[model samples]
Target: MQIDSTNICERLCNKSIRDISWLLNIPRSTVSGIITKWKQLGTTATQSPSGRPRHMTERGQRMLKRTVRRSRQLSAESIAKDLQTPCGLQNSTTTVRRELHGMGSHGREAASKLYITKCNALDAMV
Candidate 1:
């Protein structure tokens, strides 16, 4: 198990914060904060962080994947247009490109060959 400052504080319950900090090699303020948090919250665990939400939903991502699978040759601009029209998602080409990249799809197709050679006689001699 992890040895947090709380464990250190619990072990040296009668010791001062500075003494615990010196023994554990932790800053006094950090050790004090952990002990304070444990006393107040009854746990040393951290809370989840809050952040901005995603621009695209799960359904929209699925629709975008389906559209890309249906037409592999579609450009980012065309994909954005299709998303706005049929999929009812109004995202920019850059956003569509970013999402495609995030989904492991670069929207680039393999080059097609117009002709094939059976053998190269000169290469065989070399």
Candidate 2:
């Protein structure tokens, strides 16, 4: 259900905040804020939330995509090094991982290097 303030305001003249909220299916707090702003500025809030600020530009993202597409098996560190060397965008390994993940690329799995050293000398005491 879409709420159109213009239509609702036209339908209900001199409606209270609660009335407006109930009719429009919006939060009463939001309606109150709107009414307060309307009283002071004669308009409602219009600001929209922009997504997280981009650390890299569109050109940089394109370059990164190209680099990853060229070498599917490139390590995160290697990719970061390449980016820093050619473009001087020296981002950390974590940042590179995030960028690749954002671009719909799969993260390379790290090979497990677990090792065990038996302590036979310590067992001799038992």
Candidate 3:
């Protein structure tokens, strides 16, 4: 790593990027990006030690919603069953429920056709 990057990483290890940016006279985003890259490359400049991985994907979200929409009154277990054959998504009913809750569609609306366009997802993410 560059000397400047090393200094920035040292600062980031002890301080938040906002504080390091102010002290070292660098952009906060630059410090943040460098730290993220280090972590991605398995060099831990700064981060929590570990956490559970994310369970569902965008496709999984749409599939779960469509499954629910198709069988409006099915329990989470039944929904998980329906999903197994169609999309090969096997999770505990609890897992399915949590993913549905995260997607903002738990027990609220009838399962209907919902499509995820690339533009829409990009807009949501960024």
Top candidate on TM-score is: 2
> For model 3, where is the 10-residue window of minimal lDDT?
1-10
**lDDT by residue (tens digit), candidate 1, 1-126:** 244654555555787877777877878888788777777887778877789777888988999999999988889898889989876888888888889999999655589964534466555667
Residues 1-126, model 3: lDDT tens digits: 463476556765787778777777878888787777766775635566688876776788888888777876889888888778877877789989898787777676667975989998999999
Compute the lDDT of residue 77 as modeled in candidate 2. Answer: 92
What's the true lDDT of residue 35 in model 1? 77
Deviation in Å, model 2, residue 13 alpha carbon: 5.0
Q: Is candidate 1 or candidate 2 better by lDDT?
A: 1
Give the top-scoring candidate (lDDT).
Answer: 1
Write the number of the candidate with greater lDDT, choosing between 1 and 3.
1
lDDT string for model 2 (73-107, tens) is 98989888899988889688788888889888987
Q: Ranking under lDDT, best-scoring first? A: 1, 3, 2
Off by over 4 Å in 1: 1-32, 42-51, 85-87, 107-115, 121-126
* RMSD each, Å: 4.5, 8.6, 14.3
The worst-scoring run of ten residues by lDDT in candidate 2 lies at: 1-10
Poorest 10 consecutive residues by lDDT, candidate 1? 1-10
Question: Model 3 RMSD to the real structure?
Answer: 14.3
